[model samples]
Target: MPDKFDTSLPPFDCLSDSQQQRLRDALDVAYFRAGETIIEADEACQQLYIIIKGSVEERAADGQEIFAHYTADDLFDVRAQLDARSRHHYQALEDTLCYLLPREHFIALYQSNSQFAAYFDGNLAQRQQLLDEAHQQQNLAEFILTKISDDNIQPCLIVPHDTNLTAVTQAMRDKRVDAALVKLNATPQYGIVTRTNLLHAVLLDSLPASTPVSQVATTPVISVNKGDFLFNAMLAMTRHKVKRVQVLDGDNVAGMLDLTQVLSLFSTHSHVLTLRIARAKTIDELALAAGSQHRLVETLFNNGIHTLFVMELIATVNEQIIEKAFQLVVPPEMHDRCCLIVMGSEGRGEQILKTDQDNALILQDGIDWPGCAQVMARLTQTLHQLGYPLCPGKVMVNNPQWVKPQSEWLHTLSDFVQAGTENAVMALAILADSHAVAGNRALLSPLQTHLHQLLADQELLLATFTRPALQFSVPLTLFGKLKTGKEGLDIKRGGIFPIVHGIRALALEHAIADNNTFARIDQLTRCRVLEPETASNLSEALKLFIKLRLRQQLGQQQDPQSRGMQQHLDISVLSRAERDLLRHSLHVVKKFKEWLGYHYQIRD
Candidate 1:
């Protein structure tokens, strides 16, 4: 048992072998039966207690409430021991054994080891600093992998869908819940009603107090599956603009996930920054909000937020910027007449920062709106003001070629597939990734369906679409190292694009509707187009490419005079672990291209 606790290990590892032996020799194994008080409130703490088995609870003076718990391998009452007093009632939770280090021996260790001393004396910030350095020292950060389920303290409060607003509000208030899950017993249809929903319904919409909650609630509840990464839950909430998400346990409601819980867990600045963007009422205000974007990214990245979460958060913020811009220029009536869609990285929800604009307008057929061109111009100019460069190909809505009636878009898609011209095919590739950011999304869905139907049987076209994935050299030398240019390897041209474009092309062939690369890989795997291992490797490779690109881009940004470095990845600047990962990822990229070629019967 002592061997398992390993007194000579971290928070104690700095102690010399002799010191460890001295402590080990002084260690007295003590036992306490359940409910026995280990230390009373305000009593002097004469020993340092380390749990070897069972658990102990830190309780209030009356022992009615547990403030915290300590289990196996946990050290307790260090602050109290240092101050020579017990701060709370510490009682055994079960029959337990703990190693007791006498005050004299503990003082000797404290006087001897600075590393050991810093840990016990440190506050939250100092402890977090120690966690920040964990990656470099083979120590793991427990915070990074914290599961969402750990914070799900509120069992989901369920109410019948037919419950009136007055009753629902009273029920939520009585239960001390800010949200309620409205379940329909007849059809299994469940929806979410939050405090915000109630506000919008009663205050904004002026709905009657007797209105059923299900009528006011958000239908088709967006939820994060149980066991999903907590970051995924946060990301899902940000994208959907919801305050809470249902924690689903296989189609059953397991619990409720409040945004506050996630925010507390991360304590990140990005969420607040994103809210600023969402609240901006004018172009100047939005530009001010957008200016802090670089700082937000830098801060979150340094704090060890995963690249996937960071990218999604950034993309979501950009979407808010674009949506706000759309709202500024377009009237309420015109919103239903056209679908403003973004393609490329923004559409795929992978963009980390503002880049070139690749947007188009899908106008409803037979709509008489003379201000369409004017609105598109204002929208494009406003986005440019927000730091998005205009698309070089004039894909912006202001360009008449990119803005057309829904019928025209459907016909154009058909023509593009049949002609298979180079320019037409490039346009098709862009449209393949299009996602509606504002306006009537219904106008865009049918057009996407028409596109899929036109090329559903076109095998030759699929091969042609995938051929551009081989346009660039692999950027790896015959010696299996990254091939570098004067700047660095072309990260986007050689790695990111091929994987994205290749997967997108394959998706088109299979009629997979997902635009996100990771989602496409999962769908492809489920459909047996790729093996599970291959899919996982591809996903990992894509993430690595994205992380490298963002780092390289940010690095280039640090030098004010640098130019033409967007896709350039300086191999020399990468850490050993990063470089090794890059080498292996590029190998995976090469294999991927070869696999695509073999599968499509396209010779190299």
Candidate 2:
């Protein structure tokens, strides 16, 4: 009756009530005083023990401590107890009470419940397979369970290539469809004609209504397989920046899937948020729309949308938000004289969650708007109210030092590369990832071109730039174990920063213009600056690290106390597969850092 034999832990939690009852009946309560040996190294483990109300410490075969802490509700001797022997010893660190289930009963439960059995029986390799399954499950977006074929696709409205535009319009009106697929010349190749295309041709180009349907259509249409997951269709649409995708059944054209139709299945956020931002007539309306952005992110992440896709989509929306804010705060006449740029992650289009505002304004030479400072301050404040916290580093357009003329920006870039001070290196690093988000991007173009010229073949400068990549020790120990500190490993510091900054430096050295970390990795490989295998490995490592950081970040918001905790990750909270992944990814970080030091010839 003491807590009814807690079976709430894993493996046991998966058991049926009857199985649980059997466990409850068989469970024997046992006690151990402080320093008492519950199980000795190299001895047979008789019973699987669950710490009901005390702490137990585990030691390796050689008496070196490993993961020594197990508290209430924790289970021990899972692997070793199953095998009837263990190489490690477990001792009670204080007065302890444990619910012990005999090995035979555990085997019985294991025999009946495969999932429960598998959890206990799995070796490291099998656990890795479980991890793959877990990741694959996470990869499946909510919409992915439905295939394109499962949706009620409108029938294809097939028309001949030579059919007149008048007939095409009539056919579309009759079918009540916005788009039609054109069957061209008996070949599988097809074209697409939408209402917009027709309108564009007739009104702008002044084509007669009698013009051939083919003339109005876009040639070589994009399509999604009927059997592909609905999520894939969404990804296709996002990647192509299109509003619709053609559905195909092998060589035959099926029909078109409008973005509206597809998005209606899920949250309004997928499409409506962007639509609202585009149509919003006032800054107030845009602010209201921005409120739903975090919900959208949570939905996307919970449903397992890949981080990069979320990054791209969110960046687009955030840019629109910034653009709208700029329009609200700036006069139309002044827009042409200045370029607005987002630096750091925002500039790279890799920003997922809201972070500090890192923006600047580049005014044309000899151009200054009279109330520029106040206007920029208002813009930064608006973004903050919309959830973009102001940059602690003061790298915002509101800072006069950051808001400079294009000529000054040029001089500053030259100074940074030549001076090579820590501040200079940091400034150039930020600019290297900078992207013009609003206003005239061309005004900022010349500065980038000049900066590239300065960066080319500057070895000492390159080494200085790459030096930060080697700043943090990779969190993996020499034997490939995750080395945790009191606050846990700083995953961002030890993993993400190395990959992001290392690739950024190499990109600057090789004069690669891509700012996205993933794209930089690929470009480096394609240019043979980094080997394909190395690039591929580092890419996986970076993505996994990003995923973990994002999860921790998202997790923190749910609990206020968690937000106060350092970004250091306690690996104990991670599952076997996640721990393995982190361990492996940290190893990748180690190798990448070693290569960076070797490439730059850095030493202690």
Candidate 3:
């Protein structure tokens, strides 16, 4: 054995110094020649093996089916070591050197270190979560990722509705707080008076100090739940362009969260980005803000924040950027008369990197705008210039087919549902996930109701809508190894689309209103449309697929010459645990696809 073993790898990296030394002291080295059997099928495994160099393969009892590949720095056969025997054969594909840790020592280490042991035990989701938590612990400000609690909330001053503005101001000053909550006798029941509101009321509006504080307070204040994520509170502040928000426990006020409180934890880049986007008077300035988004995503992801949180944050940021673009380009008078909606991944709020513009315009009925076409064309051009590429399928607002009056849009959806042609079904599927980003959001409600009603009991149409999800193979071989092409695997088609489309079909069948896949999965579980375990597996699997694909996409984007090359999952570079997770995740996908096929009664 080498004088020092590498303790930097996962599972091992989680071990304490004493645990590492104990493991190292018990380690022994072994070598196997090419084509030699390291461990025969059904034979007792005396020790755990960690490859130092070269490659090995695990095969079935018959030695004809390959199950997995383990390469340099890959650890293997934890199951075999624990069970004392495995119904699989291990053979060296090339000359191999490995360090062996005796079964007794390994078991002792496993018992001593729960984290190290969890790496070997638990389901894929638990294992991935443990890894994520381990990663997050490395970042000092990851507390921002935690939910809002008493630790982050501050006590707020509450004044009666009849309290004068001067009294409220004095109360705020005495409490050393920037805002105070006012008790209202009306429907909202509560309103907030900030220093800004007080200033505007007294100076700008020239109101008297003796006026009731309720008159100066803003009603229906923007607030976040006490149980909501601190990051979400920041998102609310970014979205509404406010510095402070009330924290609520049920219907009652808990405390207040200020922008300064959040900034004090860590100087945030997302807030700066949103502020820039909000203040951008020209498209060029918005483009600059848009350009920095990818770097921000990279920073958050690398800092070990949860992937879902990152997605939610990016989705909100993207929405704000798009909304700002809309306000800058469209005529102010037409804003309330129309709604802007994004479809596909953008609509689902799952998009990370900039992709094609899949958007449309829903105008109010009987409204006439002479230069409407030109305005939409300009908006599309501005988005393209802001880093969002144009849709090759022409799904953007620039295309007149996608921009229409609400009445005509509902009619179009009805026609599509009734026709049930392949193209029509595909179109309906796309529109099912549409989300309004700008303009009057209420305008799309009628369309949502109409579409849901049209397909209320249309079993045949639902099945047809679900058929495309199973059209692509799951990219797994019979023995459960990943299948890849010369360009690597197109995870988008092989894994992501199947899960997304399958979930969408289920949601549509049950009229689940959530557009995001993760939300849809939870709602489906609550409705018992999917078993709890299956729903959990599917959610975890989809997260893995998206994470891997995002890594590949980012890698491709970083390479200048790789532009225009289709992004694919490069399996050769994955660690053994990741590859194992990928296989297990794909198995989850395969099982989901089978369930989809049977549930929908889909036939060849």
Best-fitting candidate, scored by lDDT: 3
Q: What is the lDDT of residue 457 in candidate 1?
A: 89
Model 2 agreement with the true structure over 1-604: per-residue lDDT tens digits? 3447656545566788888888888888899999999998888887888877887887887876564467676677877756789888888989999988888888788778887777656543343334434454333365655778745566768899999888998999998888888878758888888989998889999999889888777877778988887766776665455787888888777777878887777553556776677667777888898888888878777776667767777877788778878877888888888989998888888888878899999998998578999989999998898888889899998899999989899998998888999999999999998888778889888887887889897888888888988988888654445778887878878988999999999988888888899999999999999987788778777777777777778878767576435357877788544765577677778888899889988775
Instruction: Please provide TM-scores, in order, for all candidate models, with all chains considered together.
Output: 0.73, 0.71, 0.93
Deviation of model 2 at 529, angstroms:
3.8
Candidate 3 residue-wise lDDT, 378-446, digit = tens: 999999998898999999999999999999999899889889999999899989999999999899888
TM-score, structure 2 vs. true:
0.71
Q: On a 0 to 1 TM-score scale, where does candidate 1 land against the true structure?
A: 0.73
Candidate 3, residue 219: how far the Cα is off, in Å = 2.2
TM-score rank, highest first? 3, 1, 2
Global lDDT of each model?
A: 0.80, 0.79, 0.87
Q: Which segments of model 3 are wrong by more than 4 Å?
A: 33-35, 40-43, 54-66, 92-96, 134-141, 186-188, 250-252, 558-563
lDDT of candidate 2?
0.79
Worst 10 residues of 1 by lDDT: 132-141
Backbone N/Cα/C clashes per model:
0, 0, 0
Candidate 1 Cα lDDT to native = 0.80
Q: 589 in model 3: Cα distance from truth in Å? A: 1.6
In model 1, where do residues sit more than 4 Å from their true spots?
A: 1-144, 161-173, 191-221
